[model samples]
Target: MYAGCFLVLSLISFTIQTETAVYIQHRMGWNKAYCMLYFTHGSWSLLWPMQLLILRLQKWNVPWQPFWRRHVAILRSTAQMIQHRTLHLTPRQSQQSPLRYMIWTTAYVTCALTVAGGSWYVAVDMTTASDLTAIYNCSAFFAYVFSIPLLHEKVRFGKVLAVAVAIAGVLVVAYGGKAEESTPKHGGKSGGGAGGPDHDAKEPQNRALGNIVIGIGSVLYGFYEVLYKKVACPPDGCSPGRGMLFANTFGSMIGFFTLCVLWIPLPILHFTGLEKFELPTGDTAKMLLVSVLANATFSGSFLILISLTSPVLSSVAALLTIFIVALVDVMLPGDLATPLSGNAIAGGCLIIAAFIMLSVATYREMDEERRQKEMEVAESEVDEDEA
Candidate 1:
């Protein structure tokens, strides 16, 4: 039940993020509000909400332990029980393997760092929120690539080809959307005009940069997904939930550090004697507040969704974001519409098709496993009864 809710919430969060990004671009002209919001509020708001959810589970009697503890307990007990029934084994045989733990811990930390750093970098570099959101939609490509080797999972050749087709589609969408240049408008001298009042607004340059940064970030994020699945639980005895909790906690910490470092360079580079930092206007503050809340919801739900579903599913659901954003854009007056080209439509369909194939494969695998388990139990029962 929780998993189902998490998946639904995750889908909703992506949709909301798309809508919010569009709103920010339409209202704030991409430069002033979008970049700042991504740097400051994006990770911070997400941390607390997710933390609260994890803590709530604990309060409701969920057992939480470090990866080592739970796995060691299982290995120790299994070895002891086996030894009692047969020949006694050496102390080393009874103990949990340290090398395996070390390898997994390293992978987890590396994944966390990559994801946190990439997220921060993209947020800092991306000029427009829509481009950032769109780039993230391509994360499924990375997820599929990493899943095979990292998670020891096999995908069908058809599904692989479908994913490739989806990538082609994404390329089409990225190339089709062209940005236009506009002059930056300044509102009197009440607030700081750090870039100067007449700083020419180069929308095309910013959009292109934003798209590139976001696309790279999505790839890095996909690698993180594989790391999480592999190290999240060990057969020797770690709980997947506990591993996820630690990784997320550590990832959030890294995000905070990255945010601070990114912001440090920006403040120092402010134009001299143009306009110093001032309190935000009433409307700006209100907008920031709403964005923060929406961002938090999106972030918290995303983590929960990832925990509940595979990275591929999460990635597929994210593809829906573009459609949601399109709806929002059409409803709003004076918003620019990038005409749907043949490539864009084809890419969208390919992505959707890939997701369907992946889902069918997953379901088939699960059913087969369940049947095998049942057969094993039935065979054991028959042998016992005959004896």
Candidate 2:
């Protein structure tokens, strides 16, 4: 039941976030990751509070009065912990709103999306949009590796095989899925070149570099995801509703850092002629406004999935976005559409098969766990009657 709910929600959220961001960068003329990061991070700030307030109305534990105060304290403590390399949680603190949990959320926002999101948008400039998304999702295998030790999810053959399958699929999509329309030969008179951003990004070398950077971002994001499961949404007593509220609130806080740190570097980079850091204006700003809203909901929904399901499931679920985004890019009336390739189709199939395999393995574990609990309950009843 939990898995089903999570799967559906994850699919929607991942699709919305990936497709919107790619569309803005790849299709529309707005490709500033710095601007995108501010909006993306701010989206959480926009969303989590409203959801928390809703929970409060429903009688869930929503800290109202001093919550913002504690939020500030958490930020300061996290900064201190970073500087001193000293952070610990007491047993009681472990159960409540701990600085560790908030810290991890900030780390995820900065490391995963802020960093990864930036790389991903830049990647869009170089590679085909679909290919960029597909390759970046190769993070599933990275998450799988970290899950074993961090999540204590047992290493099983089926799960391992699934990871291998998905990785192969992503590679196939990245390299051989060469859309007929992707190269000049496939260019249509409709003026939809599919590599629409800047003409220079269409270079083969730039595509290669984009792929490398996106892949690196994926690895780091995978780490962020597994740690989120293990640290933020522990299986002991946390619920999706509760974790969503806290995780997202902490995530929103990262926007503050982005506002501060990313701001300073923009002028430095601009003045030094390193990279152009232009603020969004007009249509670019409008697109960012809409995209960030999607991002906020995306973060909220993603955390809910992680809390209800495993990190591996959440990661694998994102693979579906590649197919969905690719289809949209191809079908939509725009130059951003890369021609759909046979290899990409094959890759998508392989990835879907991998998802099924992982699902089956997870179900088997759940069955065994259910049986063990039932047996324990029965034995306890027997002892009670015997007494």
Candidate 3:
């Protein structure tokens, strides 16, 4: 039953997020800065505290007073821990400072920039859903690469296999050969427009550029995830729940700050005629509303996933999105040319198979470790009795 619910929610979040990204970029014409501002500043992001609070009270039956108190204590503890050299900024034991705080906050800023910037590029440059998704999903590869050196985690055969297979799948989906041209879902014209063949000729170049941009964004975000483990988690002083609570609050505060600081750029850009800023309206407004709601749900679901499963598994679960997004693009049209290429299907299958292999390996290893620990404890007890 849990598995079923997990799948359903995962599918919903991935589908909505993919479509929202595509639609916003291809059709919305909203600037990246404005998009980030709207998302983070004095808006839904600021309300994360209240949103998380309500979730806590409703789902865990946690008392409001206790929850509030725990949040306060955790914030205090995390600060002291950081100040006292108890918790470093990263696995390298780098010291924390106001500068580091600003740097980490860039994770949030960069996150916004990547999503909005990448979407813009994809909308204007990329030709298919497979291309957009294939590039976006490369973050899993980035995560694995970063994890080994930065986190100093042990390398396992199964994990290596999983990563290899998943990456291979992405390559297949992307390069497996183009599908027959059909009506673009979001109405990107290739064969027509004022420029004619000269315009059409640029499509391949633009798409290659977009793919590169997306890949870079994927690398940054993969590091962001590792940073969360290495630097973002408060410390051993706070319980997992409490750590998460203040982390959410801390992020909201950062978002609020970003909202204010970001205003400096929009007017400059607008006046300079670099990128025009406009409030979303009409279909754009409606689309944003849906995206925000979907994002909120995704965030909440992600939080739940972390509690229920390891972050690594959670990431694998997200990898499934690339497959779903491409499939959706094929089955349902929001905007894009032919998405269901033969290569994409075969690639998606490989990715899914990789995820399953990883899951089995992870669980099996965990169980073995648990049993080993139990045996050691039992042996120690028997020795004590004989004495």
Candidate 4:
């Protein structure tokens, strides 16, 4: 239930974020991609605080000191689980500080995320939007591949087939439509925080190069997702609330790193005039705020979803956004709406079908794991009695 809610939240916010990014760059003429990325990522820092407020409100009857202490302990214990990648810990391990490990992990993980995300901007001008969409979304396939070794996920035929179908759907949506004459290109901001393509940009100077770069980015993005699952997510059998809390806490750590370390590039970019620093005002500022908040919401929900489910599932679920975005475009007023192609209808159905198959498979996997654990527990109790 929580997983479904998070998925919906992520899909909605991601669509809104994508559209606002386009508006901010094209309509408002604020083309600072890095700045937008910085602000949105930094907003993650608010998650923990917001969570704390909600938690406190829930326990309003409790004494302040006790509530605060309990909150600190919960965070510390969850941090330990993340650092060690398990819920069980030895006395020595529990006593040792998880702070250093967490800080280092958060730093490197955020670095990976930034690079993977930045690739969108770097390649957007160098490739067709069709290529960008198709290639980047291929991260869903890579996520499943990486999960085999990194996550110890068994190579099940059902999962492989589902992933294949999902990718096919994406291809259909991207390339199945009949070709039309290319529109005249305009000089505008080429990428946004999420690294979306600037469709209005000139033709690619080097299609081959852009494809290769974005391809690397796609692999890296998948690796990042699996890595987070391995390093940050709580071990199996953890309660949903605990998983959600820790997910937001870890998200805040990412946000904190972005604010403290990633800001260094802003100055360098400004000095080099690669992207001069300029603040948004008027409607631009209003819309930018909305976009940033929406992104924060999406990021938080996405993290929680990954913690609750497998990265492969989360990545495949994200593909739903492509169809949703198309639907949104169709709803836009005047010239903004892109006509819904037959390919989109066909592709969207395939993607949905794939998601249903994968979801059933995942549920069965979880049930089997649960029963196996129960058996192990029963066997352990028998052995203790015999002793």
lDDT (10s digit) by residue, model 2, range 185-252: 11100011123344333454676787788777777678777766655553433444444455555555
Report the C-alpha lDDT of model 3 over 124-188, residue by residue, as the tens digit: 34434445545555666666777788666568888878877887887676556652132122111
Stretches of model 3 off by over 4 angstroms after superposition: 1-10, 24-47, 52-67, 74-135, 179-201, 204-212, 234-247, 250-254, 303-312, 330-341, 372-387
Every model's TM-score = 0.61, 0.74, 0.70, 0.93
User: Ten-residue segment with the worst summed lDDT in candidate 1?
Assistant: 185-194
- The numbered model that scores best in lDDT is 4
List model 1 lDDT by residue over 8-76, tens digit each.
Answer: 664565455444443444455444432443343335435644764666565656454643465446444
Q: What TM-score quantifies how close candidate 2 is to the native fold? A: 0.74
Model 1 misplacement above 4 A = 1-4, 29-138, 176-218, 232-281, 334-347, 379-387
Model 3 TM-score relative to the real fold: 0.70
Native-to-model Cα distance after best TM-score fit, residue 164 in candidate 2, in Å: 2.1
Give the lowest summed-lDDT range of ten residues in model 3: 187-196
Q: How far is 66's C-alpha from truth in model 4 (Å)? A: 1.0
167 in model 1: Cα distance from truth in Å?
Answer: 2.5
Error of 1 at 189 (Å): 36
Best by TM-score: 4
Residue 18 of model 2, lDDT score: 58
Judging by lDDT, tell me the better candidate of 1 and 2: 2
